[model samples]
Target: MCVNAGKDKESAQPPGCPVSRPVPAKPAQRPERVSLLSYLLRFRRDILSAQPARLYRAWMAEFRTPFFTSFLCNDPDLVNLVLTERPGDFPKSGRLFEALQPLLGHSIFITNGKEWERQRRIIDPAFESGRIREVFPAMWDAAVAAVGRLEPLADGRPIDIEPQTSHVALDVIFRALFSIPVEDRTASAVFDAFRAHQASRPMINTGSLLPLPRWVPRWRARKTKATARIIRGLIRQLVDERQADLDAGRAPDDLATRIMTTADPQDGSTFSPEEMADQVGIFLLAGHETSAAALAWALYLMALFPDWQARVAQEAEAVIDPGRIYFSTASKLKLARAVFRETMRLYPPVPMYLREAARAERFRARDVPRGAQIIVSPWHLHRHERIWRDPDGFDPTRWDTPEGRESSRRAYIPFSAGARVCPGSAFAMTEGQLILAMILRHYRVALAPGHTPVPVAQLTVRGRDGIRLTLTPRKTETP
Candidate 1:
């Protein structure tokens, strides 16, 4: 029987299944305003708080500045047009590159036109569906290791799960890419430096928003630059070592090896050592940080809804053998997968994606000038009042319903969509589901007393103070 099985249906909807769901901490209500200064100030605190509640219903909204015009698109059709149909006309904003250049340096995340195309061509094969299956064992090993680490920490004390998830995600990336665990000193150093770098940089810096002169110098704090240098140096070391291993014919067959050797089909060009470092930096940052944010929020949601957690645990026991998780068995974790998907809809990791118009375009009957900033916000679209029914509620079972299926097909884009969609989407989903199942199989998660997480957008959407939860060992009966 499920955790809510014994009570009347009305009373037993689910634990924490009030008429309303528990939303992460939101900013206090403020009077509406359109001033750029106000937006900048509010954005520094929380990106969600920076926008007006009206965006939840507006199909499209525009903001004009002395430097550039910006548009926020909420309509699904416009979103599809920008992301899928006419993506070529909307290149990644130069302002985004300016802000991230110190750390990312021409990475695929911030490139445009032919440069972006060439990089994707070389990188895409490493993330193909078949390649993901080849890499699943590494992910599984990391998930098992994470469960082992958590076992001793399941002592019913309030624990900040964000860092824990980050650790596990980094471990997974390292193992998948280099055939090494994060415990390796160079890997550990890069991980530590990344955390420091993220602390020093906001997701949307002023340079990306404000119109500043080209020579104004986008100021980066010394600490941020130092950390970026340290991170890049560590990655370069790994790349050099991998190159030496390849030359000697002893290289491990992993992501790094595959990427370094794959040449552009059109030109037979390969990534240079410096270029390889940039790509690795992005893979580590994007792959781990986003996955970490998703996992932490998912665990928090499981804690908030114990009945759902119980169902996930039961499913895990039925499908996953004790002390063993296999790539072949991942498809059996249906309930866990639904829970993970719902968590993403509520707390998308990369909350907003920014692009700039490459040429004049018309969207929703409005004239958009070339160089205008285009914002496609997954955060708003996921909870759009006009799109989602019970938009703020936590109901994983909705996956089984017609409305839920329709909404997912249309509005759900935790990984964004179209040509530039995240290549590792499949890998991320498999990893998240595996970790959720492994954790739930051995533990019951609950929120700490009086604890609430405030959602903030740094490089990824994360709890401002951190997500605190209590874990207790679960006693499972043999099937």
Candidate 2:
């Protein structure tokens, strides 16, 4: 289904400027073509390689697709051109967006065009740095609560950090987004329904990759419907409560209120209750899931590299003043931040991004026919051989300097990028650093005997079997 890059008759030629001269014939050029068989061979080659970065580079040297295709590129400039420079011409893929639609509905993350813009306007204000500052207390509270829960586990005992991080992040998201703890039975049910729905849906990497119909998967359809019911009921209750508060001329200055009050500048329209629920659903999923992935990965990395963990602990100890209890101190731990950045580089929460060409266009000198689905993987880019010096290595020190940050940005995209970038990136990073620093301050983690974290692609890049580690009391205990 490739479309040619030519104008239609209505826009063909203005009266007669170039009618006299025939267009010059150009020699046909092969655009790095790789047949389906060769493509899968390259895919397997890269997947099996010890150095995946080099393999990705080799894969990029050719094009491959049998049915519906995806162009996997590792070039930095080319990527920037696609994601940042001309994003309008390359919208998020319809297939991918539709797959997420069951869970996210028409939320900002899944929708494009004017609808996406409107949703973004309503929700973006709540994720501002100032808002994140307001929510720091909530995040610290969750981290402290998590640490308290883990204190009972003795040294040498295996601990699954994924559930712990998940719980902490879910608490943070609930408090930050709604100013209410997720302890209510109604709220718990909503989140439970969502998790069930996620599990029921088959593993579809991106929308375009799957050919299965929604009805063919009866369980998925049921879960989708159940998810909508749970979320809608929760949203209706919350909205009514907030509206009642507003009626009484008093409302908490929480995320809910902020979104309720935010109006589009151009049209000055507010989100309806249903629309607000959709936005809430998105933030709830995005906020918790992303932070959980980052925090868990950060801990896994720390466990694997004890020297760096110790260094981070020292940095955290030095920065945090006794009885201050401010999460803002997390920002001062430069090395800790570097470690978090490195972890994100290794296992970006949003590992892949998909876009569909708006119209036939040329990328670099290669022709990209319209309607082709383009796939870009942060998992591949962060480790792209040409982009990083030693791509596979866990080197936090690589992010210690200005040059390092620049280079990392060229390859690192845990939050994706451009207009569609994650709106809560600052909040996520701050929360991750604080949680990570707090964990380091409280415990010394080691790889549980016979255990190694194996990351796999899922709703996020998660440890397939769960990240198990041993917790030992830190040597430098505060008096």
Candidate 3:
């Protein structure tokens, strides 16, 4: 029998209830089953709203749709086991391949099996630890060039940092790869085409959850073709120039030249013209966009957290000399490195990573059926309650502590993890810290009045309207 509280009829505990306090009545429920389309639509609606992560969590709790299936793996060992331990059993989703095929077309990021191994053999040697220092001069040159361009900005005036960071990142990619500066006309045209392509890449919501044919996206197809033509043409020009040089036995030591000369050990093969175009396309898209997004977010975070910003500035001051910034000095600024790590934790440029079950598998006693699409989102992993202390709070000091270091590396994956992890990860980290340090050496950045940087997950995680900050030159000349 139910018992009402003496004060109010609804406040009393029910008879035979385990707890002394009244059990609240459950909400009324509808008997109707939600269709897959409607469910996907609802999920999309939640993603578009603010607090997308929360929306993602709630959807994952219910059904395991294609979208959620990929996003629901917040468990640590489970993710590790899938991505690192037994990667052979879990490949990138075929659906994802289908979606990006027009743009990427069997690129390293999406391919698997013998083909992926063959590509890795050639690319891995180029990005190994020993060659990193060899590329240092190129990185330094690009950083200095970028900072010089920003020197003309009015002190204490607000500047949109995306374009500034984009220029620097593009410059780095250009100089490192082509051994040439990025021309304004070329940069403008290429960036414009990419922007148009990004916009045309289809609205990623419930629609992405549906298994639809590729030809259904007419506008997207057109944009893809146009973007491919513009960028591929540029890539072809660079490749032809490098190939001609290589054939003449006079190729330079730049990345383009290296890629042209390097052959796969497994197959003793070099990239064909079409294959080279794809590789260059990856470098152009993944290379610049990831770095630019991270640096932009890092700057915005610096402005938002002035204490950390001040610490970074102080570290830069100690390491960088007046009138000149050196790449070797970047090694001495550990605090700045920690702050960059924390910023990445708070705002990873890429949010979701997708994989598919190649065959039936078991993960922690749960059956992962064959063909099950799996998603591992850094967005959720970085913020999971069990993985971090004060997960929601912005605290750079957390990274300095031993617990923070272990926890972060285990949970924090701004560049992702496993075999398919971004090859440009180290290059990006070095570039980001160096650029941030160089920029702070010259100017103090603060959030502009009435400006709020809102995080949005687009092709990359970026500020919805761009990060705007006030840049003021430091007073007192130190010669």
For residue 472, model 1's alpha carbon misses the true position, in angstroms, by 1.5
**lDDT for position 167 in model 1:** 89
- What is the C-alpha lDDT profile of model 2 across 16-132, one tens digit per residue? 433221111111222245455654444322221212324346425323344465566667776787788888888888777656765666778778888888888777888887777
For all the candidates, what are their Cα RMSDs to the real structure? Answer: 3.7, 15.1, 9.6
> Where's the lowest-lDDT run of ten residues in candidate 1?
1-10
Ranked candidates (TM-score, high to low): 1, 3, 2
Could you tell me the lDDT of residue 293 within candidate 3?
A: 82
Instruction: Select the stronger candidate by TM-score from 1 and 3.
Output: 1
Q: How many backbone clashes does candidate 2 have?
A: 1
Predicted structure with the largest lDDT when compared to the true one? 1
Greater-lDDT candidate between 2 and 3? 2
Q: Model 3 Cα displacement at 262 (Å)?
A: 1.2
Candidate 2 to native Cα RMSD, angstroms: 15.1
